[model samples]
Target: MAVTANKIELMQIADAVAREKSIDRMIVIEAMEDALSRAARSRYGAETNVRAEIDPQTGETRLWRLMEVVETVENDSAEIALVDAQRQNPEAELGDFLSDPLPPVDFGRVAALAAKQTITQKVRDAERENQYEEFKDRQGEIISGLIKRIEYGHVIVDLGRAEAVIRRDQQIPREPLRQGDRVRAYVADVRREPRGPQIFLSRTHPQFVARLFEQEVPEVYDGVIEIKAVARDPGSRAKIGVYSNDSSIDPVGACVGMRGSRVQAVVSEIAGERIDIVPWSEDTATFIVNALAPAEVAKVVLDEEMERVEVVVAEDQLSLAIGRRGQNVRLASQLSGYEIDLMTEEEEAKKRQKEYAERSALFMEVLDVDEMIANLLVAEGFARVEEIAYVDLDEIAMIEGFDDETAQELQARAQEWLENERQALDAKRREMGVEDDLLTIEGLDLKMVVALAEEGVKTVEDLAGCVTDDLTGWTERVEGEKKHYEGMLEKYRVRPETAEAMIAEARARVGWDVEEEPAEA
Candidate 1:
């Protein structure tokens, strides 16, 4: 069957709209059918059940006045007597519809305008849907577009089909955007709203640096080299931890390219931001050491349980390690996923002496010892009285000038002092209305229970539900400044592993199933 010239023109219009909107041709044709149906309904009784269909192959249009077969016909427009419906189809049951084919509807002025608006709105909706589906999965991608305009510091980029906006905060600070300038950015997110899909772009995201490296360095894009971590002070400085799966390949050299070519390309893209491609390591200590590049690390003290590190450097290198306004160390901390504290060698020495003096004083007061004896104990690595009480006698006896008898006497004194302290703490705990069942947890002692009471954790269930951070606390970096927060047992020296075990033990004691740690992928 041949299509008429008018039918071919209708198909051509659907094809054109579909191509222009980047939507399916069938969607455009369906929208057209809906527009025509609405126009027909305006001419016919609005309540009448009118239906329209357009053949996809020939653009053949059909219209029908559908009336339901009923025993009693109260509405003549929408209902027909069952006997009269059987004249059209013998199988027309009470629930079925009898179709009466009507002539093609000639659109009047008002109806034509309404139909045009309906089609335009539907096509616009389809276009927005297409845009969302196209860019939703393209997040974290590098996209280039012309800077269309800037509205109150937000740079709007026309991404060919859809528009994306780089919020002021997401843009690199001090980098001005000009209209018609070509800009590349990371597709941060895509959100669907009633109007259209909101495409968010970012120039300051750490991944933007990683992506730049990906494009500049073949090794980075390939599986040979993997960029493990990235941290950026956006357009000022950045540090990335890269690792190589192949033992022969050096990740840092690969990312740097020949004669700084690869790294320089990335730096130029982000407004001359300095890039530090540190080699990633399985050892957290070694990785953090590399992260703080351009400064020699004199010493490193890692508190793995606390996820913090004390990096002591020479006085001359301290300023360089910390960088201008503490940018270097801040990026290092963020890249390494550890709270870092930088100290000069002399400062660290002074810090050590202060701690030793404090520990000596604490021992002298607690165990009824003289300053000389307490200082000796502190020198022997007895930071807490509990450590002296619980340590093996042989280890204490091995100390210079400390015989077996002396070790036994010192241990006895330590244990006696701890018992008295525990009694005082237990009394405080009872006075504070802490539950007695809290003592049933194996690792928790009387002092720890009192500390828990102070922090409002007073029951077995409370301890059971606690996370590692809940008991041991956590540290976070804000504006390049390290903020320290004390946990319930921060003074008692509770390790993260110990906290988790104690929580599990408490849960088991309270008849709750102790959960197992998840297996690594």
Candidate 2:
């Protein structure tokens, strides 16, 4: 073995190549040895059976032939006699490992080519390993990186050696990102695809806010305070329910920090998304009330059977507790694990009255189908619709007009009405605003406009001003021309000149314009 100047320079080149390509130097050394060995074999002919070794420290090169011990060898160039193998090492047996000296010839061109190819393969493999290690443990953590560019809606985030992705659904609404601007997000998910390792990041996830709290508040990390539930309308508002093991420590106060420092940090990170940290209570009533905090709850009536809670707030607090389009109460319902029904006292009282009216209407709808049954109900002094709806059919038959067959029919019809009434009452309990009130209208009545307004549909501005989906869906529930309902919405969008004509026509309708009075002599 001899150390050549070329070998010394090749070692230096391997070091430089490893650093440039982010490959390991050991791979370059192994590949160089293989190339030199292959060159020796080609020079001496394929029968030479050559192998190569490099000095670990000095990078000296030597080539030799590896021949196995044989009983009788047909090819003497590649096989060693058993006697020779035993002489080299006494433990060597027939077909044992043995090496013979091979004549070294410089096959400069072939060796250089083989060296280049080996280096390339080794470098690629090493780079792949480096990439796997770099990104393996980064799952579920938040990363802040530069937005390199966007292809489709997926943003490439430059994270030093590699880039991660921020998918379209992961992005917050109305939040714009630009190249070079730093964006931070939670690592929502990851997968390996044909392109490479795919990483998904998010700013809208509820966990993103929860993680921010953990980072900002020491109480959360120490497990003294726990985030029980989180509901987010990302980029707008977030509600987090927090509970504390320590009785004296206020969970809400801990999250809020001194002068709102902790929460403000999270809000700032979310690009001014508001965070409301409410104290978590095991009691469903208390939890619901707290969930809708900042908007006082007058009462919370829990329905254990249906997993629902009717939340009654003050008249003025109604809008605040319900938020814009019931976003507040919706989040509260999610946080408290109950189907929430939000209303002001005025709204609830009106609902009770409406329910009483529906029950009465149900009684008449069924009994009026048969004259004999109607007479029996009337004779029972079930004069009010609710009274007939509530009274027993057996009691009706005992009086007069009802026989066994008639009584059975009346009873069956009354039960069906009662079930329908129950479903209507339940629907009213879950939703608020115009939809809740509009249910009272059986068929489209000209009086619908007035009745709706009286319940909660205050103004045209109110009627057409809600979310387009909620408004359109409400209008379709009317059992009339679909175009007429759509046209009402189209009317709302009309220009002022056209609106004037429509308003004049609407004003003439009895209840359309409350500002104008009835004509009197």
Candidate 3:
């Protein structure tokens, strides 16, 4: 090749650099133009207004001094009078740039070094931008690379186009990753920093296991089976919940493959991590039972209000259901979206007995009934005296050993007890200085009014300031004892809808300010 200082040679250099750096050709050309402009400024006095351009097709370099065509030339290097500019171009107007070509200079060592530095910096910036654009969209995807090196416990992988890093916390615990090892990880995040694009990879992410299955199982990749949820104790064990839209396909069996081949592939990739493939169910109880695999469950009791589930297993299966260090139940909880509490069948029986005794005790004390009668009421599923007072007389008479006369007597006693309780609460409400307006609120019964008065919420204004959680009993610690406020709604056992209506009515009445009484004069 002949060495020539020509436009063709300049463009060839640009094309080569662009291909090497994987950057746009025009970007490389623009960098070259900037370098040339700097060199031209050095030669034509530092104060000269210089600009440079390159032909996109021909790669020709043009260096010129730019001066504004102004009426008065204050800065000789930057501005030229209209008369002088008109000599070159008759249509020269004020504020127009008049470009004058300058002769090219021979390359000096110092100038060449400066241009090299400028070009290198520009190329580096463009390379970073290219890397960010390439990897930003790759998040949540599985990426494979060679482990380039380990810097302070972080594994830097050579991803061919750009390098990615897996921090110490992101790697599977105790996973032995050596330099030059082939590693597969999930692209967790991509951040553009001042230095370069930061690509974060993770081997411990739940999605990493999901992606591995996607690669190993054709059913998952083709959307025949959907991976509903995944929970991993990275490098130890993991659970995957899968579902299938096609009735012919078994989601769990498809994920497990024939004789566990599919799951085995994913396990091998994760360094011998065990995987439990479970079929997903729309029913929460069924899903939780499926999540706690390898153990037979006797029963599952769901507390929908608390979003918790109690799983009772045989005594012998208790340890297995809970897993080593509670790992099994924890992962099951995460996968099923419910807090799981594991217990043996014996323990559950004891708990039921304790709850039964407590409910019977509550009824006996509140309704002033004998223990035998309280037990009968508890056995009939009457947990509260309010149910007894409001229930149909025929329903109570239907109970064994209870005739119509007895039912009437029980109903009269219950009603009398409630009335007496209300009268006492009303007296307390008056003594607490509760405003009459609060008592008039439709949902504010005598019991709720008394409870609110005790809490220092005696006025409509005070009631309106309370939040829903405060209005409905909230848990707190008092004097080292865990106590619940048992707010107006909870103490009276009012329905939530009724409580909301009462609060709304109170807020509407709270708009009027309570006027202060004048002192005796």
lDDT of each: 0.89, 0.71, 0.86
Q: 1-521, model 2: which lDDT tens digit per residue?
A: 67778778878888887898676788777877777776777777778688888776787767878888898787777888888778888888887768766655666776678767776776666665676566667776888899999889878899776678888888888888888899998987766654556677888888889988999999998999999999999889899999999999999998999999889999988989988888888887898888897899888788765567888889889889988877898889888777798888988889866755554554557655644445445545464544544576677567664576776666666667767766665545344334443333223222334433444654444442333332222334345543334433332233333434333443444245544433422
Top candidate, metric TM-score: 1
Better of 1 and 2 by lDDT: 1
> What TM-score against the true fold does each predicted structure earn?
0.75, 0.53, 0.68
What global local distance difference test value does model 3 have? 0.86
Which tens-of-lDDT digit does each residue in 4-32 have in candidate 3?
A: 46878888888999999999999998898
Q: What is the Cα-based TM-score of model 2?
A: 0.53
Q: What lDDT is reached at residue 446 by model 2? A: 28
Q: Is candidate 1 or candidate 2 better by TM-score?
A: 1
- lDDT per residue for candidate 1 within 119-179, as digits (tens), equals 9999999999989999999999999999999999899999999999999999998886899
**What local lDDT score does residue 235 receive in model 2, on the 0 to 100 scale?**
89
Question: Which of 1 and 3 is ahead in lDDT?
Answer: 1
- Please say which candidate is ahead in TM-score: 1 or 3: 1
Better of 2 and 3 by TM-score: 3
Q: Model 1, which residues run further than 4 Å from truth?
A: 1-3, 65-103, 357-521
